[model samples]
Target chain A: MEKKFEIKDLITVGVFSALYSIVMFAVACLGFIPILMVFMPLLCPLVAAIPLMLYFSKIKHFGMITITGTLIGILMFIIGHPYPILIFCIGAGLLTEVVLKMGNYQSIKHCVAASAVFSLWFLGMVIAFFFSFRDAYFASILDGYGQEYVDAMKSYTPTWVFFAMIIMCLVGGTVGGLLGAKVLKKHFRKAGMA
Target chain B: MEIGVCSNKNGAFIKLDPRSKLLLLITISIIMIGARTVEVEGVLRLICAAIPLVLLLSIREYKASFIYLLLLGSALICEKHIAPYTHGICNIVLMMICGLITRFVAGYMMGWYTVKSTSVSEFITAMERMHCPSFISIPMSVMFRYFPTLSEEYKSINDAKRMRELGHPFSQPLTYIEYILVPLMMSTVRIADELSAASLSKGLSAGEKRTHICEVSIRPLDVFAITGTMVMFVLFLVY
Candidate 1:
């Protein structure tokens, strides 16, 4: 139950959470390709561990990830993305920390597994939310976009086409995160931080 | 022949302070968003913005931005000339150009206001900007720092082969993406060792306060630019 992070790490997480809102908002302005949007945070998580590892690599950094995850959750809510993004982040981070406690983080397998778990974390939340509240979720997306592009945005013609896009985003995000982690593993080592 | 990616101009821009650049980027972006659609307005915006952007890119003498420009220009032509079955090419091109002009405005503001002043600082302040922990910036910046260099290395590695670059752009873009991946990853593995050493030498531990040399003050020039952009934006909104 003891927190493993320093004060500044918390501040960093808060700043990044705020950044997510603006970055997503800006991306929304440019395009709506779900594939890219889903994987958008891939790069963030890729190198996200460096700071914690760099500073608190000595102390447990799992709790630090949870706090950052909460910040991201708050930021997403402010940015109008609904609530589960927060829950996914915390649960994923904490679980990854548990895995790390098993001494798995040192190897490439651990990084990849941690990434996959979180990737699934986001996917599970999106899918569950879609099933539980299909109409509301679709309505919110439409509200975010509006009725004008509502029809076009839904590439699938069936009423069920509504939730298909979320699945697509999740798939894209999962792939992107895996790729990001793999790439990150190499890059961090090259940068000499590993 | 590669398109849509920025050049090393960002590295130089990173030298400037961040606050100054943010004001510049936001102001210009507001103006661009405001003036997103008019034809005459679009072309004028392109010119006013393009001049500075070209000068920035010129420092690097990088052809990537020019190629991107060429692709954008060609896309406009295609959207006008080919994509629309009903409208004439001229009309489509005109509409496309008008839409693109807003991005030009946004692009220039990014370069002049934010990038020129605080390009490097963006990486350091990225967490603050993104809601992540500052701990992440070390790896993020390291990745960014090495990315362009790796790209350059990848390009040279490709030149060692024949038919890869020329054949990919005109004949197959996916081929281009495919060919580039291996070298980039290999380069990543090779460089990872060095990055680790560099970070360790610097004692880059998490929760540490990293210094930012890129300081951007909202100067008189910045105020004038913001005011001018806001006025123009208001005019566009009303008109």
Candidate 2:
């Protein structure tokens, strides 16, 4: 089979990417609860797993995953994410695509690994905390939320916590991917689609 | 239909190229994101917020622009005057409300204007002209086009669930979520397949330079908008 993305594959990518993004957006709305906002790294990937799994099952070519990532990155930027996050998102997508390629696009194990890596896109959003604006971010948090809240936040988000959040995101993705696979098997596969 | 505001010839007060609209969004987002990190001058913030409202008005989106203005005014007032007086939970809630508004509203309004005012064809043409690979442009356009369809599907699903009395959010929330997602995914796949088939038959896969009837050009207004945004961005950096 030719390894080129046809219009059908591209459109499938588009449709599924849209679904994945909508799921992500819906999950993000939960951030209205102040405490739940901190768990965004986990919640988004976990909740968004279903459509992504469906999208992955349809992937027969190389570029589909990267395209989905880039598309989502642009959407995020449009929705007010910082510009540099785009680069981070594209990198995560590319890395995930490589992981999926290692399994030749079929192995459930690789798909889970890919999901773990793809979840690093959340890292892009929080990356400013580790690198740029570390002081300003906290200062703003202090200003808006008061020193007590900032103290609570800082305690919750120490240097190690960044790595912990990364791990949490990965675990969320891994579990999500597995759950997604099961969902596909229980739903789409029995429907003779997957 | 008359394609978009770009093609509305005699109607729109200020016609902008999609490329320029995209540029304006990037500029506004950059400024607003910066505003969040450091307290920028209030005047600068106001200018940034006003850009989208003015653009919306130019497109004759009177109601949306007015609503945005009202929201911005109220949020500004609450943040400046009322927020300091509140304490504890109310304070945090007030701050959160103000922060979300200041951080997101301007960019969201600008995005709404960009998406609402520009047709998919015009967007694709702009992307193509900017030399974005068709791989990105094609799916991006399709994704843009599909958002409305997705929302429509979601509403119908909600309606169906209500009819069946199968799920409710407060009770059986997980089941309600599952009920919502499973059918949504299935219908999404089916619709995607149908859409792909239709577009393929329309020769979308022919893999040649496609001709579009929507004439997209960088008019003087577009030049002005792009340059003015860049100047503001440079000023933002320097200031």
Candidate 3:
């Protein structure tokens, strides 16, 4: 039988998108903490994996993950995030769907792997900061805030911080995926999503 | 249904088409993100600064608007001057705070305003007229409906957990997850199933053109809003 998403799958994706956006908004609010800001890229994917994986488990069809990711990207774009971020999110979602499909959407290992890949999409958040360290970026700031302020701001952000954020996202994704799998095994399975 | 944070209250914003509001949001975001010099940023800030004022004026929300304006004005001032004085960590922290205010807060506020003012039927009609594919329009329409229902569900779950004496989220992370996630997931599945059935029965998946009872036409306000924002955006880019 040809497998196309039914109306139910669409609704499921819609509901899941709203839930994901709300959770992400709460995470963004928490990121107001200066220290927590750096960790947010890491923590968001992990926290998000719970709902995400649950959604994934229930709908094991093709294109569902892509739909969710595209909706999220559009929502984020509508909320003023850069267009590039939307592209990045959709790409990550496509990869995640492929990974899950490869594992037949039934294997716990594949689910974890898919979750980890999906988490990497959060890397788009750091792109703005990363660009700010460049000479062109500095020139733009210099035009507005002058040399002294630009210098001060640049000095505050070390080059290593960018790399550190990337590393943290990977670590966070791995841990979050594992945690989501554990949750699925212990709780969601009993709840019938398994 | 309760409109949540985006309640309309018969504001002037509600008079404009949802498409116009969407266009305005896109223009402002592009300008804000692409802004390079302080002059451009300042102009963009000033433009965005008008949004809350308009919202407040339209809604007759004097107190809330006043507080919002006060906070916004102070943050702009701090971003321009106080940011230079603070050195090292303080400087970073202050800049982050200021950036948050200037860059994102406006966009979010505008988004909230649009959500509040535009009814779901109006939004769906606007999307359809824009030639959005059914795959997208169907899900987006459902997504809009999902938010209010989810809020209701969250409240009931909270009450149930409270009755069971489950610890608050702040007290026990693990137990909180166990209590909340399981029930939420289960209910979400059920809700999704029910919602799909209802929508399907309503001919949502018939692959036929759908019409709306919600009359959504571009008014003079929409034309002015879109044109005005576009002209301003072009002007900003020129200099």
Candidate 4:
């Protein structure tokens, strides 16, 4: 079967890729405390807003989404955020895709949960890569500064960080769904994608 | 569609095969990075870095190359006087920026080149021709195409952040993180699935040998560029 390639599809890809990269660049630019990025708000919400996955659910695009993720990975990798950033992205992306599938793309709960799980994987990767143990080696670079770095470590806990991350992810996902639902629903209506 | 970043250069720089460019970037990057201390090694790296700057100028990509040198120069300046005052932030920022600039330029050039000549099918085929594992090539090809997609997503995420932050008096870093990650992750999962399905529907079988739409050849221009790269690279090293 000779399938016609739509110029519009390419346009769509271009738009989304650009949007995705911008989101990553903005949030990822600001350094965090732990250091968690204070700009996480700018990033997660926008990403969650785009209904790319929902569109995928109806269509299941082949290389489009993965390619976007890969570009983001390369951009950051080029920027030098250590190895875990890339690892987390790939790991978390896969996890989210799996979770989305688990829900059969029929339930909003599954989508939200999937995004949360996806982000958690990245958080976990960060902890494992930087710290020796939970709360034991929280501030990675400060470990060398000894008491100076360690002195301030007392302001938080691993559980707190985890909970914070989960909340953030939840908010992010919810917002993402809200934003994505409209565009993606329209996208799905204009079908033959999957 | 540009295959590599060099296309933007538009001169002799763009004439070289992407493979050569990759080789040059890798070799130069390793040597520069290997210069352990700023004294003997750092000085050498600075000199070596100049060669690329000149090539960039000749290619008319002076701006990009200048940005690269600026990073190295700033690092040198910072390491000399501001090291202790800034608590090493200057050095760290400089090194990372330098690293980022080099990779970004190299990737850009290669990406430009790939798009100009090779079709997606050709790229996949070439990997197979080179004896690359399907597992590896499939992912690489996927990643290559994905680059633009990711960049796009980042753009939207950035805009959303801008909107929210601007809404408030002083947007903190925490606020940014809270919003960005959610959308970014959401978009990622969405597209990945669609792309996977689309590629599948296209019957993108990895096992089959593919065809090449663009002929890849090493021209005299490539030789000249590489030779120029070597001489300058050596001059920088020994200087």
Per-residue alpha-carbon lDDT of model 3 for B1-239, expressed as tens digits? 55432334454534678798888877766655456535655666577668646865675657766766777778778878888787766776677677667666667667656665677767878888899876687788678677777778878998999999996788897787668766776777888888888777888778787776666788887788888887878877785
When 2 and 3 are scored with TM-score, the better candidate is 2
lDDT order, best first, reads 2, 3, 4, 1
Q: What's the residue-level lDDT of A45 in candidate 3?
A: 77
Off by over 4 Å in 1: A1-159, A168-194, B1-16, B26-133, B136-140, B157-183, B202-216, B226-239
Better of 3 and 4 by lDDT: 3
Which regions in candidate 2 have their CA more than 4 angstroms from the true location?
Answer: A139-155, B1-10, B36-40
Report lDDT (Cα) of residue B105, candidate 4.
Answer: 43
Report lDDT (Cα) of residue B39, candidate 4: 53
State interface RMSD in Å for all models.
10.2, 2.6, 2.9, 8.9
> What TM-score goes with each of the models?
0.48, 0.92, 0.86, 0.55
Error of 2 at A63 (Å): 1.7
lDDT at residue A88 of model 1 (Cα atoms): 66
Name the runs in model 4 displaced over 4 angstroms. Answer: A1-19, A30-42, A45-81, A84-86, A120-129, A132-171, A182-194, B1-16, B20-55, B86-210, B217-239
The residue-by-residue lDDT of candidate 4 on B1-239, one tens digit each, is: 34442233344444546555545554455444333334555555555455456556555655676676666566555544454344333434443343334334433443333444334565555556567655445555555566666667757878876876533324564445445544554565566657756756755544354444454456787687678667756755574
What are the per-model DockQ values? Answer: 0.08, 0.57, 0.53, 0.07
RMSD of each: 10.0, 2.6, 3.6, 8.5
State the DockQ, from 0 to 1, for candidate 1: 0.08
Model 4, range A109-176, lDDT digits (tens) per residue? 67656545544433532353224453433343231222332343333344456556657766775666
Top-lDDT candidate index: 2
